[model samples]
Target: MLEKVTGLSDLKEILHDKEDEEIVFTNGCFDILHVGHVRYLQEAKAKGDLLVVGINSDESVRQLKGKKRPIVPEMERAEMLAALEMIDYVIIFTELTAKNIISELKPDIYVKGGDYKVNELPEAEVVAEYEGRIELVKEVRGASTTNIVAEISKRY
Candidate 1:
């Protein structure tokens, strides 16, 4: 599973060889894995031949989600995502947005949760620049890491 976790450069080279395959890209902090994340990834995989997940590094997550967030560290989060059968590759990035990765990979499809609108995504431009398709998967109602963490804190 750890083998599925790769750096951007290595993954780029590997993906270059897979030009024949339709590649799907999605990114998130994935601070705490949940059913919503699984379903989203599964749906993203269905969009193309390969699914590449870009995980926000600890610093990035901290910047986006606050310092107390990401109860699970970056490497552990990457490993957990890499272990998923539907995910073909996992890359940890230090960016607050997926724009850079999306620009570099130029995957055939870029996916996000339904909660996001295409016009609002910073990476949408990058995807569009390369003529990549953007997809939004419907989110599992009431299923989110923020809610889960809130519930845990309330119970504890």
Candidate 2:
């Protein structure tokens, strides 16, 4: 049922039809797709009728995160996140942040992992413009892509 990774424009159109439903937006690199990512997505979904995950494009990942980052490619990362039942749609954005997408969709709720301060987020202002509230889900400490990479390096 429309389960696949899509572009921002297409997602905006699709979301237009479901304007009445509460849309929750969250953005991340999700390079390794760890437990923390899964839990965060699940919690985000719980906050609204639909969960839209904005994944940083490969180029954007390299820009936001550094080289040697995003061990998994953007398409693969988006595909993995879209596979999760908790995520209603996966939008691969080219920007370092999902501010443009947020401005266009103006989701009812914006969720982030506990690591971030709501007011500190650059998108906070965009969300605020639409009166959207930001929610932080409890993070699974020590369960990060960096930690996974470190462990892999230690093993091999």
Candidate 3:
């Protein structure tokens, strides 16, 4: 259950054994898992040997997505991602940005959805410092948590 969810210290230890493996990292709120999220993660995994997802904590999500957001709890969201075969590990981060985690992990490839530009990503600088490349995955059209929530609200 919690096996795939790890803290920074434990993740660091695990990463030590993956020296020969290419690590791909991506961070997001992931409030509601959907086809878009699935496709994005699958594509991210294709770029490296292991895909490490940095999940924004509940507090961070509230700050970023608004107080009423994150209809799903952080732990549950992490569990859902961990259950996916495309995901290798899940790390919950408390900060608004994954800059610190990116700096520490120094993944071989840092991935983001097509909605973001490589140069526009704050983590891009950190990845650059480690000589890691940034890749933008194609987004699934008409799929987003906000839209999903709005549609749900309209129904009930």
* Top-scoring candidate (TM-score): 1
Better of 2 and 3 by lDDT: 3
lDDT of 3 by residue, 35-121 (tens): 999999999999999999999999999999999978899999999999999999999999999999999999999999999988889
What are the C-alpha RMSDs, in order, of all predicted structures?
Answer: 0.6, 1.3, 0.7
Compared with the true structure, all predictions reach lDDT values of: 0.95, 0.90, 0.94
Better of 1 and 2 by lDDT: 1
Error of 1 at 31 (Å): 0.7
Q: On residues 2-95, what C-alpha lDDT tens digit does candidate 2 reach at each position?
A: 3667776888889999988999999999999889998889899999999999999899989887999879998888888888888889888898
For model 1, residues 80-126, the per-residue Cα lDDT tens digits are 99999999999999989999999999999999999999999999899
Please estimate how well model 3 matches the true structure, expressed as its whole-model Cα lDDT: 0.94
How well does model 1 score by local distance difference test? 0.95
Clash pairs for candidate 3: none
Q: How many pairs of residues collide in model 1? A: 0
lDDT of 2: 0.90
TM-score: model 3 vs. ground truth:
0.98
Question: Which should have the higher TM-score, number 2 or number 3?
Answer: 3
